[model samples]
Target: MEPVAGSLLAPLLLAGAAFSNHLTDSYGATANYWAIGLHISCWIAQFVGHGIFEGRAPALLDNLVQAFFLAPFFVWMEILFLFGYRPGLQSRIAKAVEKEVDKFHQSKLHGNGRATNGKIIRTIASLALSLAVYKYAHGDPDKQPLLTRWLHYYDSMQEDFKRKTYMNIKFVEEAGKDRHLFETAPFVGHMELKFPE
Candidate 1:
């Protein structure tokens, strides 16, 4: 296929290169303008021809390599088949194309790849959920998996609050009012603010 495609395209490609080279030799830098115009026009013609003759968008829209490189081989093979090149191979190809088309149609009906993607996502999510449930049900209560740890976060927070409460001494506003208590306090000779009772 590569050799066939290369052989079919090389002449045209070389001719185009030669033409551009000739333009550059004759017209200097101005040749670039003409070459650009021709290049654009050729691509335009390619897409227009695909629309008119094939009645569908060009393969370039979906796959550039298929349109540019492989298309010539495919077209050549089809032409060969028309002239009885390989009947058996052609029949097999036809069957395969038919099967693929049917598969495509079925997938389209099932919402065109979304169903498959959704099924995968659902499977992953269900497995994660099931694993979480199993861990919460049977695993040692001391250590929890990262995924299932959030369920106990509030309880852990409450325990932390209890610990924090035990660690802190109560603050009494009147303790500062007694001069002896204030004198014996660690903050000696520090300026203190006293509010009226």
Candidate 2:
């Protein structure tokens, strides 16, 4: 009905990014809790805004999607950050989150093969949730304007994250460098280099 939810989402995401950065700076490899908190907060903010402020109810099904699937999108991002992607002011914050996740898995939280499986599961879950939200909630022509705008923002973010991730992995594969996989990663000019634990 209004741009309230969309507008609020931008700040929510920014806040999450800021918070993550702070946590990363302070705790380094032990920032999983911060990532989880950010996801949970985002979900609550969106849910409340859509249902209360927008007066849209947002459907129980939509609520479920937010709770069960969409909430973890951020968490998955954190896991990806652990892999060595550097943070960019011009890029999506998801890249940073993913690097954090990789750090968690590589360190004390070592999950062995199961942790890798968790990443796969989370990926599937996020895709399924995004599809569900897109197909069901974003279909109404009346909502197309808002939905399209939101998707545009989301896509830009997702793309930035994906691009950085691809480049980081490619660097590792080609140079056989493991620096991009560290938790206390160093910032080098415009690129990020992760250190080995």
Candidate 3:
């Protein structure tokens, strides 16, 4: 969310710099200096918001070219949400965003786990690593169980990938536990597993 807001505000800073150049041509050196200073200050504020307040890298650092254009449009949509517009699509968009974030975390774990050897050791290490990463990423105590369940699914998928076998996996959310049903092999039958939170 902070990344999105930072991305949205970035273009305003660019516009300010452009306006400062126009000021230099017409208004005088003093006006240009003030405009440039304002632009610099705002840029610093954006970085502080992202790095310090948000606890995440600014979106620009990840993809400078895309951030330059996308930030403003994203902010516009956020503004609409704030105004209670598009109420119906909010949950759908939120779920999609959650999936993307989960995918990113899973990929990060996979990348870090590649250095380790041995299937059992790697699986155990990856599970621990994923739990730690998810905990840090979420920062909400109540969501720990959900994160654990997500890591369980992720671990299963990792195992399936290594075996070069496709598994039909289905996730069911229940009151007391999260259940994952995996059809490992057609003739072998289905495996029902419950991951502890």
Over 4 Å off in model 2, which ranges?
1-111, 141-197
Q: Write the per-residue lDDT of candidate 1 for residues 86-115, one digit (tens) a residue.
A: 788789989998997788667667665665
lDDT of 3 by residue, 1-197 (tens): 54654676678879988885586556654563465457657755775675466444456555766568777666676786798856776677778989978875776566744432233354445446756864675575654444344555776898978665433222223312432233332465577899998
Looking at model 1, the pairs that clash are none
List, residue by residue over 25-86, the lDDT tens digit for candidate 2.
67753464455447557765765675456333333333667656565554544544566434
**Comparing 1 and 2 by TM-score, which wins?**
1
Candidate 3 Cα misplacement greater than 4 A, ranges: 1-26, 102-197
Worst 10 residues of 2 by lDDT: 53-62
Q: Which candidate has the highest lDDT of all? A: 1
On TM-score, the leading prediction is 3
Candidate 3 RMSD computed on C-alpha atoms after optimal superposition onto the true structure: 27.9
Compute the lDDT of residue 63 as modeled in candidate 3.
Answer: 76
